[model samples]
Target: MSEFKRAITAEDITRLQVYSDPQFTPDGDAYTYVSTAINDKNEYESHLFYKKLNGSDATPWTFGNVKNSNAQFSPDGKKVVFQSTRSGLPQLWVLNTDGGEAKQLTFFKNGAVSPAWSKDGKYIIFNASLDHDDDVESQKEQSKEERQKQNEEKKKQPLVINRLKYKSDAKGFHDNKRNQLILFDVENEKFTQLTSADTDHGYQDISPDGNFVLFTANLNDDADYELINDLFTLNLKTKDITKLTDGKGGYHSASFSPSGDKIACLGHEFAYKGATLSELYVFDIATGERTCLSEKWDMQLGDLMIGDTRLGQSTTGPVWSKEEDRLFFIATDFGATGLYQVTLNSDLEVLYKDDNHVFGFSYDPHSDSFILGISTPTNPCNFYQLRKTSELVRLTNANAKYLEEVHVEEPETLTITADDDQEIQGWLLRPYGFEEGKKYPFVLEIHGGPHAMYGQTFFHELQLLAAKGYVVLYTNPRGSHGYGQSFVDACRSDYGGGDYTDLMSAVDYVLENYSFIDENRLGVTGGSYGGFMTNWIISHTNRFKAAVTQRSISNWLSFYGVSDIGFFFTKWEHGLNLLDDPAKLWDFSPLKYAENVETPLLILHGEQDFRCPVEQGEQLFITLKHMRKQVEFVRFPGSNHELSRSGKPEMRIERLNHICRWFEEYL
Candidate 1:
């Protein structure tokens, strides 16, 4: 094995590190971020960590073996306000900036999130699901009444509900109706409602002077709920609300400048090649001159957090520096994320250049250093402080202890030409302890969304496969983002045709170039669209010995009415309009070719998934079993489509173990 000792296990899923909501303290000398520390019991306790920009170590500010996160510093920098589920429901807690016993601020039942400090730090502003109720008993009563009504009406179709909140992935469909602004008094420990309205007013950002709150809402009770997300300013003292931007498209992510005279935000008002992209807009609240920064300053404005974001735009994440003169935000050209800086005067600059991931950034003006969070394909996430030098010094080594025993493999990117002569990008992680000439079995890994790009970052499951002596290959196919708009749009009408060719070409490239990879013993797997494609591949050719599809859409016709988002995404993605007849949806369904399948298949799904829904997997498994194909189905309880990403800890570990067990059993 290339003269090095061949290790039995190159890597194991021992540790996972992540940093959330990194921000600078008011003085700009220290930084704080929400860190989820995991332990052997397979439980997680999120805590806040603070380190001086130039200080040697980050100090933990929470204790008592509880869940804590989302820390925001007070204006004076003496104390930090954070959120914790330690109380069972997410509530606000305040602690000294230097570290002290935390005191609970809000005793809420419905749950509170997105805590924002007023400029004066005397008041805390946040959105709470005050009146939105989904009580089990209430739901039962409503459901029973609805069923009776439906029976009486004798509707065209039977009325049924798969779940209380169906179609939930990483984030559930939040029923925060009339999600109003709640004000908490720090001194008196009393709570007050700042804005009490029937309409939902979300995304609250306090002005620099703490006099106003900037937010977006459908104040007019508009019919097209998807239309404009107009900006509004609420006078916290007088309780007066004023509308700001009148432009079309969603206008959100508003933040006030240090001077309090101006505000910068992301605005979706332009269309590129029939697709919408956002522009950064800085509204001069005093003069009422709303400037479109993308048009005037060449700033990149991409749509972010869209329902189908991985397949669309990710133009979000904007926050102003302490000086308020420069605005920092994330920009995506093709599929990779880059951090950019835009001067309020209309000049844009690239701050950091790296493909894929950029996060955990804290700009402390007092220390003149940036505590940045970064990650690459081979490297697990680590916090770094960047000062005068370009190189970063590491802070927390979360995976050091576990990684000592594992010989983790790093990924390498490559370009493979498809049959259509289109150059498609791909990455391969050679089996850990790889040899020069000895061939090893390989697994073709496909990312979900079919639009999400598998960029530079270490994936636990992907690495686990590599550690088990199987070469792992993943690629960003034609419909994937990160390349550009056109590349992502390429797979729209031609779902199984050109996209299939790209995957086959990637495999061909692997067989031709990698002498250590076995083309004879090959396998394929993916989730979501990747899962759908897996079904497609095995039906066309029995090249893979085994295949596993997770939360997949095996049959489109069954997917049309069952999934919560199926109706909207169906028409948007494959042009399967609900109003018109669409035979094309069924034509692309993988179950259509189930008769030709020969490779053994394993189907994994979350029991609670309403996105692709659990039935899609069941349909595929039933049809395959009926055909007498070697098939098995594994279902995760209380899990959803995003179980592979943000599910419960025990369930997540079980998922990893099962995936390893399946691949180990087959390859």
Candidate 2:
């Protein structure tokens, strides 16, 4: 139990808050990332922490102690503009980057996000909701009052609207005014509306010349094709909005060259045909011609890399060096992470290649150098610089300082060939107390996203499980990213079919190769799609001694009716509906074989989880109880589907504890 200290305690779970979203100061000398912590008031407070590249004492900026992030220092590095919920709905706030009390920047009742600094740092341009007071329940009361005022003037009109079938995973609602672009004068504290049409203008990039702004939007266009997010340029002086990339094709990753003569943009669009791959394109601003740079390039993870399944593709942030011809960026594909430098004049060279992952790189044109954050399988994150001698310096030792008391294990990668000769790869975490010849209880962890990849990063739960003497094995199945599009789309309609086979084969490989894994005391668990797999595992066979499913889906029929993406996901993944595809969906559903579940099962859910609503867990529990199966249910009050990642700190710890306790009791 000594090593079990990494196992989250109730207090730790109760106080849990996750941090993300990193932004760098223009000079690359200082940087800031969003951190959520509990202040004296015990509220979930988020603040911006700024640290110098030279490893100086990091200072906390912003006041009132509410959640804040998406910070961008002004061009001159004098002030910072960010988003916060201090005034109810998320609004814009500006603060001095050096240190000072934060000042309110926007007062829209709807919301604002992703604040970008203007060219001269005189004004801030942000994307905000123009008018959406009528769509969501949080704003229904205000809408009712406005509707009543409208009724007083004229005849009442029926509300018949057709808009986004689903707004966003973050913001729910089909109806709302398009997210428009607005420029706010920092000096006068006034604002100038940019675009007027009912459309969304995201990625408001001010051109290098400071005379115009380049952005991507799908205004007055079909979502299917233009979803590539068409490029548009707004003249700061003339206010003339000109469409940059024309025709049916879409574009993203748009940025202006140093001289503002040429543009580097991804001219490709994504298709919903199971999997997609985006390409890099260069558009000459004056001539309006595009060239596909993805040619002769592997362009997928694992293809050009050599680390692990962390392989494939060159999806990374772009930084133009002081020399406009030289572009620096990080590239990945099915294996390892690689940093590259591309010259517009027909030459591409690899700068650095290693098993460690490199993301969020920034280059300071004045210094002719770069600074970025990176991590590997065994390393916690820190910042580094590339200079005269390839010098690497740590900026913020955020984890090691706070997590010194806990122990984390590095995962080992292995390869196993399935029955059909299919090659599969995954990481194995050994129990804390390792005895070479002694067998240990084993657990197979599955990642959700089915689309998202579980790279070589630190995961607290996996560490706790390993510390508890459980051999943890997790793999990038056919449907996981980091692989090519065909590989990821392989699990689309074959959830319980091939994907399950890949999992079972991995388990078999682990049992055969690892002498320390107990054959009799085996278990499996996962969340979301992974949760769905956990339930499927328990119902179809008694191979596992016990099981725990979090935010799971039991019946595809119910999932298609209640989940946020039910309507489309059911058809896209299962290829059927309640009536149209009832047979296939039910066949893959875990509930159909509830009577076959002989092993004890524990069900956990979050009350506010709209993705795979808690109802799914409740239904599984109820059906098992009806079938006289051994089952227990735990509900996290005020928690959401993301309990494992960003739910309450205490609740997350509690979740890890509940799963551990259940396995300890039954396995």
Candidate that would win on lDDT: 2
Give the Cα error of residue 473 in candidate 1, in Å: 0.9
Per TM-score, the best of the predicted structures is 1
lDDT of 1 by residue, 287-339 (tens): 99988766643223432111110110112356677677788777654434556
Which TM-score value belongs to model 2? 0.85
Clashes of each: 9, 32
TM-score of 1: 0.86
On residues 1-667, what C-alpha lDDT tens digit does candidate 2 reach at each position?
3344343233442233333445557876766766665556545677777877676887878657577877888888888888887776677888886566788777664577778876777778888776633222132222446646765754555545464344333444444577777777878877777776666678647887678888888765566222446788889899998887664556666788878887776545445333455556677888988776665564442222212112111225455666778777666555455567778763777766666667556566766655655666555455566663566656666555435555567788878786677787788998886778898999998888666566566566776778788999988777776766677778888888788888899999999988889989998988898899999888777899978898999999988878877766777677776789688888989999898998889999998787898899999999999878899999999887777766665676688889999989987
Model-by-model lDDT, in order?
0.70, 0.71
| lDDT of residue 666 for candidate 2 | 81
For model 2, what is the alpha-carbon lDDT of residue 449?
62
